[model samples]
Target: MSRTDEHRRLAVLAGIDIDNPELRAKLDEVSARTAARLGQPVSLVSMVLDGAQFFAGSFGLQGWLAELNGTPIEWSFCVNAVQSRTPYVVTDARIDALYAANPLVHVDGLHRYAGVPIVVDGEVLGAHCVLGYEPGEFSRSDLEELRRGADEIVALLASHRLPRAAPLPP
Candidate 1:
């Protein structure tokens, strides 16, 4: 299928959120589908601000996500995409000058990464990223599909603000 077609399919899938439970289910389904379609091991939807990373959705790979939260901005590929406000594809992180030493790349053995920046109202919010153990190349179509998913995530976050928990009794 064409990239635009794939993106449209995801957009339709994302449009089904009625509440938190539904949203979470759609996110999981989209992430899994994206991974399956792209033949990748890991697919992630993350929101990266100045100093924090939040995993809105993810598939494949556990345990390491906790480490990603509150991680330094400089160590993340998603941060790079957010800063640049563009798609960043690393075919071989071990060979890239900027990411060769990054813990996610070197220590974790993530050789391939493709990230599309999530921009909402002209401001970058975060990114949708996919990774693989072995090196891989991303096509323009793949990037566009990722971008569509990121846009949907931004919209969802905007529409449904997470409620703040009440304080404990004094």
Candidate 2:
């Protein structure tokens, strides 16, 4: 599909408003499990939108970011995972040219990241990710854990999604 078509589809899916207590609870559980499994400081179920990336589920966040539950897309590594349609890993964003200047590296002191795309029905919607304050390698096993967490997140979203209406007869 074209980029425009993809964006439209994303808008429609996101417009259903996946924000709810039950979904959040389940997502938080997934995030916690991912963080523990990977030994990371934080985990997030991050959905990339047109303007911002919303944290559908998260753990180990503090301060204003935790309260806000999201940030502008410019600050998101999860966007890369969605765009690549595969796992995206950064050993150290502070040293990587592509991410060296990103505010999250400088301001938040977040260096390491591993993300797996959350895909459903052939469309990549977002990413499930783990973050760290220090630079380090993420093993293949780490990525695999993230993939499992991503799958769980997708299942939770599918269950909570609003059913689409059928098309009219021609």
Candidate 3:
């Protein structure tokens, strides 16, 4: 099987439903703490699946999309962090050519984004990330902490063995 196929399959085997309301209270604490630690208003713990990204936990996301479950990866900057297996950041999507045209920037008007991969046994599952509407620089130490937070998220996922979550709504 292809690595992509295996990655998707293992994601299923891990059995994390970050969006499950029953699981949110605990995950929400982690997310809220992550946001406080990173000093960002927007933070998310997400899992990448076949074509979309699921936010199992988050903070500072208000409005209609706040209740929405997932979004296509094409609309997610976390894709960069997951693919690289490292922290990815766009300090200013408005000024960065790489993200200048991204739908999250142009459509959602998000200006800053940063994330670290959620790696399990050498495979990237998805990302733990932060976002903001204002541009800001992240120090090397900040990136390191985000990476550590991603590791903590992995630990949390490993400690639980719940049933698989339903796929994102079509």
lDDT per residue (tens digit) for residues 101-144 in model 2: 98888988999999999987677888999999999999998999
Residues 1-170 of candidate 3: C-alpha lDDT, one tens digit per residue:
47776666566536654445656666667778888998898888877765787787788887644877567877778878776767898999998987888776787778998888888666788788888888988888777777888878777776666765688999
- Candidate 1 per-residue lDDT, tens place, 1-170, comes to 35564355344334333347766666667677778878899888766644566666778865665455335667777877876777889999999999899887777788999998776555565678888999979998888778777777777656755444597899
* Best-to-worst ranking by lDDT: 2, 3, 1
State every prediction's TM-score relative to the real structure.
Answer: 0.74, 0.91, 0.82
Q: What local lDDT does model 3 show for residue 53?
A: 79
Whole-model lDDT per candidate:
0.72, 0.87, 0.77
Give the per-residue Cα lDDT of candidate 2 at 152: 87
* Index of the highest-TM-score prediction: 2
Highest-lDDT candidate:
2
Assess candidate 1 and give its lDDT: 0.72
What TM-score does model 3 achieve against the real structure?
A: 0.82
